[model samples]
Target: MYGGGYVFCEPDVHGQPDDPERLAEFEARIDRGEKIEPQDWMPYEYRRQLIRLIEQHAHSEIMGALPEGAWITRAPGFKRKLALIAKVQDEVGHAQLLYSAAETLGKSRADMVNDLLSGKSKYSNVFNYPAKTWADVTVIGFLIDAAAIVNQVANSKGSYGPYCRALERICYEESFHLKQGYDAFVALATGTKRQREMLQDAINRWYRPIIHFFGPPDNESVHSKQLMRWKVKMASNDEMRNQFLDAYVPKVLELGLTFPDPELRKDPQTGRWHYGDPDWAEFYRVINGDGPCNAERLSARRLAEENGRWIRQAIMNPQQKFTIPFA
Candidate 1:
């Protein structure tokens, strides 16, 4: 499950627009609830934005697997280990599904890999943080996975057929992921005092990143207007974040867990949650590759890529090199 909701991009451009007639038809189709297929003509920016959104989603699934995968061997019991292994496997499969979806936009999987490695593309910032304990794994799997569901379920209705379809499948598996995570979490919270403390400590550490999961609010982010209008973004960052808080905060509170932020509460007047600042500066810094475990995570990914390169070379055309078509 992925959590970083902000799609970091350069400032919006008002360059030459797409052919008015074609663009009108494209948007009208979206308005009429028509799904845009791979062969359908689309505006250049539509393709670019979809590629960016889907490619980063694909990368997040892959990178998000690493944290919990690391805990498989260290899980409490054989049953837990088996479950963790299966969950991690599902995540990797989700990545493959997403990459295939993104490939429909004319970016090869190879090109996507290069972009991720070169930092031209990014995964969710939440994955860069270390999972320090078994409790941390449950929080990542339960709360973080829950956050991803909120994001993906909203986007599952987006205009792009392939991405929406991929998210459909991913969301199904993710529900199971969330269930197992909640099971583990409840087990910890209801167990011995030490177990409770461990879970509580994890909750405290994760609360900030949890808020950052949905990125900046509507006013602070520059990504909304066009993409939202096109159905590329089904919900605003604040909308998704509020949805998550409304759904999950009560569950944690019922378990007697506490968020570190005293300012986190519902505004009775507006029915919206108000929260302390999650340090947007820190979120930006982490997304830019300065987080606690960013280097180590990428290093692990690079090692896998480097080691697997020969096998990849063996299976492919000797001289086939992929590049981003639009760029």
Candidate 2:
């Protein structure tokens, strides 16, 4: 036994064991930090659930690019343009990481891409909204990225080895994104009054989606319990949302900017940040493909996929003349 758990002893029963005690021992082994390899016993639901969760996350990452990627050409300055390009590139990299994680559950990255294109899968609701101005870019970087980081930081400790490892890299990139956003907000808040007003409007526009990004609050959320039990999700929707608010609200105020929420404040005693409830109706509308910019985002995604078809085919089915020797 190890750590109050069981271990297979001498005369290992690879073929002989059909006993209930052996099953108990196997479960105990898992509980004791033992690795469950490809051949290990597992319930069917575990695999299916992980595939669903990872595929959804992968779809989100890929689609997440569209909102911010739209701004790469319109960024205000040379530096901001380069930074936006770099940020979009990071999002592409994140999609790759997430797809690799999903592939471990017997799915292909191409298949997941197809799912997203065909509208058979869903993504983060935040991306469905419009990036209306340069200020929208800053808000996306600050509030949207901040909301994503809360969920991703929790995922860095996931039980699935591939996902946990991928999240470590994603979190590192997200940290940079968060800083870039904060810097943008600072620049805007400290600029002319017009800049400050733009920043505030952007904050108001994104605030609700950022709050709802964690999903519905406890009793209303169906999948939260199972997701937590499997360690696929570490924090409840409301818990993660609150954590994001606590980290950013003070910084927003320090710059003499105001978020739209009148009920928002920090409790000096409990040290918790409080805010009014998000508009769940709008959240549903966004999730159901009815957001203000949903059609445009999806149309752009479809066009990109369509335009790249020849390129993909050319790479996958290389002509004899294009073949190079590996030597």
Kindly list the per-residue Cα lDDT of model 1 for residues 94-183, writing each as its tens digit. 888888888989989988989888777889989888899999999998999999999999989999999889889998988889999999
Reference-based TM-score of each model = 0.94, 0.85
Superposed on all Cα atoms, the candidates' RMSDs to the truth, in angstroms, are 2.6, 8.7
What's model 2's overall lDDT?
A: 0.72
* Top candidate by TM-score: 1
Instruction: Give the per-residue lDDT digits (tens) of candidate 2, residues 67-143.
Output: 88888888888988888888888888888787777676677767778888877777777778888898988988877
Candidate with best lDDT: 1
Compared with the true structure, all predictions reach lDDT values of 0.88, 0.72
